[model samples]
Target: MVVYQSNSTNKRSRGFRVRSLSHFAERRVQSQKLPSHEDTYPEPGKSKVTEEKPRETRDEWVISIKDKVNKARGDVTASTWDKLCIYRVPHYLQEDDKKSYFPQTVSLGPYHHGKEHLLPMECHKWRAVNMVLEHTKKGIETYVDAMKNLEETARACYQGPICMSSNEFTEVLFLDGCFVLELFRGTKEGFTEIGYAPNDPVFAMGGLMHSIQRDMVMLENQLPLFVLDKLLELQPDTVYQPGLVAQLAVKFFAQLMPTGEELTKMDKVESVDLVGDNGELHCLDVFHRSLFKSTRTPDGKSLKKSMSSRKQQLIHCVTELKGAGVKFRRKKTDKLWDIEFKKGYLKIPKLLIHDSTKSLFSNLIAFEQCHANSSNDITSYVIFMDNLINSAEDVSYLHHCGIIEHWLGSDFEVADLFNRLCKEVVFDPRDSYLSKLSGEVNRYYSRKWNSLKATLRHKYFNNPWAYFSFSAALVLLILTLVQSFFAVYAYYKPSS
Candidate 1:
């Protein structure tokens, strides 16, 4: 400044400084409006954007609207909404237009109460397919009444010791709610004949009877035996008199039948009696006596003591029979007599002869003859045999058969008889049987699954491909964790 610079140079220097300051101020304002490059972008040499993309305003609005619409639709479909509409629809709408516009007034109609109403009458020709599937899945309970009636009709047309093959018998006889009785005729050659009563026709006629009883409690008024016979044509076996059989049948229908608890309680007040010609009483006393005697005594003294005494007497008799080498047949039968050396087999024959009622006097006479013919002292043999035959009636052939079958293979026939009887006689369902309730619960779940499938079919049948894709995506998501687990394991696994 002391040397005094040129005027032109000073003016130029001042101009340059002003321009530089203005440029700096403009840049500062621009930076305030738009962030600094470093703040908005990645570091140099890296990508310009981060992983997350900025959402669009249009998409946000659309999503918001969709969410609101879905929420409103859910409200409209709720049970509470239906209930409210039911009570308040008249107040909400004009009377003339209410029936057409209101939700409650819309005619959804009553639910179909029967399968027949579910499908058209013309469509019934194809119902066999549904019937077969339903039968297989739910079991034969529904069609049993119809089948029983058909069987009864078939039985009425047949006569003369009518016999059905085992398979046929199984179809007709083993159905639920049916009562069957199997009788075997024993001949000299073993059991040779079998019979069953109230064959197919009886079951058919009894259908209406069961239906009446099932539907109307008051309709269970007893019917006359003659009328029942005319309808059922039931023939009681010689062993089972009509009066006794009918009494048991009535007792079974009233008290012992497996029905709902309410029905059972109702039946309790009803008396079950059967009137028969000749005033002969068909008694259940014998059956009761047999059952009581077969039961083991609580004290255990009686049976053991009796068995011990019988064993000694049995051994002596078997020895005498063997020594004599008597070649004889069962008195009233043609079957050859057997004398077994084994104690168990030897004991069985003695037990059978002891309990038997046929030819009691003849058996005693034969024993006396055998003793006189033997070289051993005859007096002891005669007295022993006499007492054995007298008390033998108390010995239970069936009970002995049970014990024998447990220990030996000779009681197959006896076991078969018991099995048949058990199949015929139905019992009240017990807790043990009701353990299958869980299976029934599973069945209900299956029905729910079917209903869900039907609903899905109705709702999305037009968009099967889209539905399938959605389903596949959902499934893939569900299984993602599993795939990830395997992938992680593979990544960490050591090379073999």
Candidate 2:
């Protein structure tokens, strides 16, 4: 899928939702907060208490427990749904590749806000803040005060805690928000025009820009869009258009989008429909939306049925499907994941795989898996591709047909990329957006006549000698039939 920022990335695998992992961190927090059972029992280093108390009547114990429960309930806060969008990538996902899930250059928001490695970028953030303030002739309070007002609302957007105090948190929102805004502004209007030196390390469209662009889309490294919008509003002479930040975002990040093999250059985004309509949560959401916006979904609806079993294969892999008479063809489109199957032909949009492609898909899938309200479209697309590509041959076929393009060294690497993407994802195949489409593909693959014809074609018509032999044999049979007919006629009519 083409995910653009004013042109940029994030997204998903089919067959899995991250419900199992959502509460892993929460459960751990609860475990730490509540008293440990092991603490109730004597510790190994502590002296063991061997004395037993006199047994209480069941009713008495029940009353004591009821009192304790009442006290506990009074202490506990009632659960209410919180608006959560950004999240830390679960360890299960991070294990495969930390770079894909974690920011490498600049930290956005509070997740990796002040790590020593990321601390270097803090000054650049300040510089961006300074430049914006200087250009607008406003004090830092102009931005920080705005953040203070929206602090609680912004905090709710994050999936977990933001440990910063009121002042500290607001400062982060201002600094990071300003930096993100400047980045978008600088990218769209040219960094030099925004007061950065031509050789300014961070602002220049150079080495750091690529890393920063990739980092910006990490699930944890996103600033709230509201903050960006507010900051953008504060900036003078800014366009007053709705979703202007998102429009600029597409320009800044869209170049990273995967285009078809023939689409060697990125297209300028003329419009960004998703951000204007979907109420984008953050920059990553903008990226995520770009990948899936207005694309055809399976069955034109959400798949409601869960798979009869877990980890079910969506459809036979590419090689097996071909063996079952399915023909692969490239659809003329730039958006990947738009696949269609008809009359044993599977037409898929050409997908160009750049280095950022994996990270983009990883983050987007993580987003869908984490966000309850989000659609599973991205996740399904990745899982669908993973299911189709089993080995190098499958990759080769797709590449040969111009459906899959990659900058990787070989088809093996492309195959491995798809094969590894859906690992450790907890998915119920039938629940995916691609589930209905997969079922249709499987049904087509199941036909005995198609399989028999495919086998015959593969075996006999595959080589010139075999085709020639079959042709000669058919010709001889036709001649013999003619001779037999003549003889029979002569005998019956006595040479009339």
Prediction 1 global C-alpha lDDT: 0.29
What tens digits encode model 1's per-residue C-alpha lDDT throughout 212-291? 22211111111122222222223222344434434333433331121112223223222222134211111111111111
Worst 10 residues of 1 by lDDT: 104-113
Worst 10 residues of 2 by lDDT: 6-15
Q: Once superposed on the true structure, which residue ranges of model 2 sit more than 4 Å away at CA?
A: 1-80, 259-271, 277-280, 294-309, 463-469, 491-496
**Candidate No. with top lDDT:** 2
Q: What is the C-alpha lDDT of each candidate?
A: 0.29, 0.79
Off by over 4 Å in 1: 1-177, 181-241, 244-319, 325-327, 333-496
Residue 396 accuracy (lDDT) in model 1: 29
TM-score of each: 0.15, 0.79
lDDT of 2 by residue, 318-392 (tens): 999989999999999765556788887899988889888888888888887777767677777888888899999
At residue 272, candidate 1 shows an lDDT of 26
